[model samples]
Target: MICKHRRYLMYISQNYSYAILRPIQKYILSQGGEVCWFLEGDEVDSSYLLTQETKLKTVKEVVDWKPDAVFVPGNTVPRFIPGVKVAVFHGFDSGKRSSKRGHFNIRGCFDLYCTQGPATTKPFQYLATKYGYFDVVETGWPTLDPLFEDNASNPYVDDNDKRPVILMCSTFSQSLSCAPTLFNKVKELSEKGRWRWLVQFHPKMPLEIVEKYKSLQNDNLQFIETDNVLPLLQMADVMLCDTSSVLIMFLLLGKPVVSFRNQSPSSYLIDVVDPSKIEGSIEKALTKPLEIESAINDYSKQVHPYQDGKSSARVVVATNELIENGLTNKRRKPLNLIRNFKLRKALKYWGC
Candidate 1:
């Protein structure tokens, strides 16, 4: 039987994911649950602001913690650990093409999935039916909680400005990378001083590309290379992205977004094939942002309907239910036997 008193919840904190998991951590603590971090490294990234006292340095330490739930923001959770391994996704499921369907692949490492919304939840539910092991809970992403709560403030913007702010974010995938393609045009646009530009890219983006953008800095252009993109999203009047989950979050605000060479373009996206068309699309989007309000509203509902800022709370509840009820069937793992063997070998080699 599950413990009835205070519950212990641990999260596996990747170097780049602390920001994405912070909201769920905050919600768990507020509800009187014990929360701690499982640091894969000897030290947590200094940017996470977590004290050394709160981290479990190894997989053995995590198992010893006797956690009731293990929350993971990224795709995988360590196997053979006690507790309901919960996958709280790192970002929106943009449905971009990747090695294994990008954000759509179910790695089978999780016992329960606290999904972003219907767009993802529905598919996982079908998977749940097929697998007959895990459970899916339609909890809006905890990362977006602050945006809907109106508690998020933009430090980047600093003051109320007359110039319209434009945020340009792109995915790191080489197949869909737009930064290299649009940098020159964007630099020209920023030079015109018609709009304020904020350029943020995926953390995995190559350093050379990041350096190239950094070299073109001007009074109107600011290049931010931080893990947190929500604050930038809040401040921007218009957003330009391609095949990145950040665009979906931008659409949550019902703003216009232009995509370059989107493989599977959606009705809500302002699609343009050529980099030269970037300026015209941005102009059109900014001049009449409300023109596509209806489509944005529809997309937002499918992605995440709850704007009440209580998604983290819902996630906590769902986690508790899974732990208390317990899985009657054995938890599932990735179907590929070779991959599972390799994972086991790696785990043993690391002595985790």
Candidate 2:
């Protein structure tokens, strides 16, 4: 049971999502709130960067803790939990219409949403208006707080390596992915040794594609697969992307980005629609990364304006308000009962 003076907040981490939610966990502790973790996989244990006292391994342990609020970075939260479930979204709302995005379905699982900014809040607000379920709070993305902080540094960047570092990232979709399209071009470019290269991809990328890139790993080029890309964003001199939202987040650093077939290319992006032009674009981005700083700053304001590293604090406060108000704030029924029922069943099959 939650104490009258100090509330308890439970968070679930699935591999890399631990990176996104750790800041909120720290903030909750600072605010005199007790925190616990609900690990997504059996392989996860207390020894994995957390103490046994703070990590609850089983569903029964989570139930006994009786949290005042629960935060989920992924889409679904368990069916019947003690606390209010808050959907701390996993990725950017890139406006991509994919089956994975849950595009229009309000799953009725989350009591509240901690949105990134105005761009992300609009659609959720419209859903709240229509279904009268869930609250949308613009708390920025807590994971990004360190990026905007004065002391945040990337330990990976080597000053001795004179070559410009080029970072490549891609989404995992045929329609929007640049992975297949730019593979040969990137391999050819990396071979030249004109630049140091880093490759990161969406965790959902197909195994075949992953192996294809793994074969190309070499001395000047490295492949990274981690939940946290913020440090990578800090270290790289220039970024090459397709439609992934990380490109939008990278712009916050005021660095240059080259996009291949970005659906809605921003004025700040160095857009290269043709795969043939990627090599040339990377050279240009490396030459003058900050030339479009003014435009990138304007774009950053639209996504997340605050640089004070307090987004996690705002999310905690908003979540606590919902805890105090109780379930009266969330809609009991989903907008589409049949669809939500199916989704819930699928979630059960996955042990979510």
Per-model tally of clashing residue pairs: 0, 0
lDDT of 1 by residue, 34-117 (tens): 776765443246456566327666567767777888888776666656677888887887767653566767777778888887
Query: lDDT for every model?
Result: 0.78, 0.76
TM-score of every model versus the real structure: 0.90, 0.86
Predicted model with the maximum TM-score:
1
TM-score of 1: 0.90
Predicted candidate 2 versus true structure: per-residue lDDT over 101-122, tens digit per residue: 4543577677888888777688
Candidate 2: stretches off by over 4 Å? 1-13, 41-53, 98-105, 150-153, 289-291, 327-352
Looking at model 1, residue 265 earns an lDDT score of 88
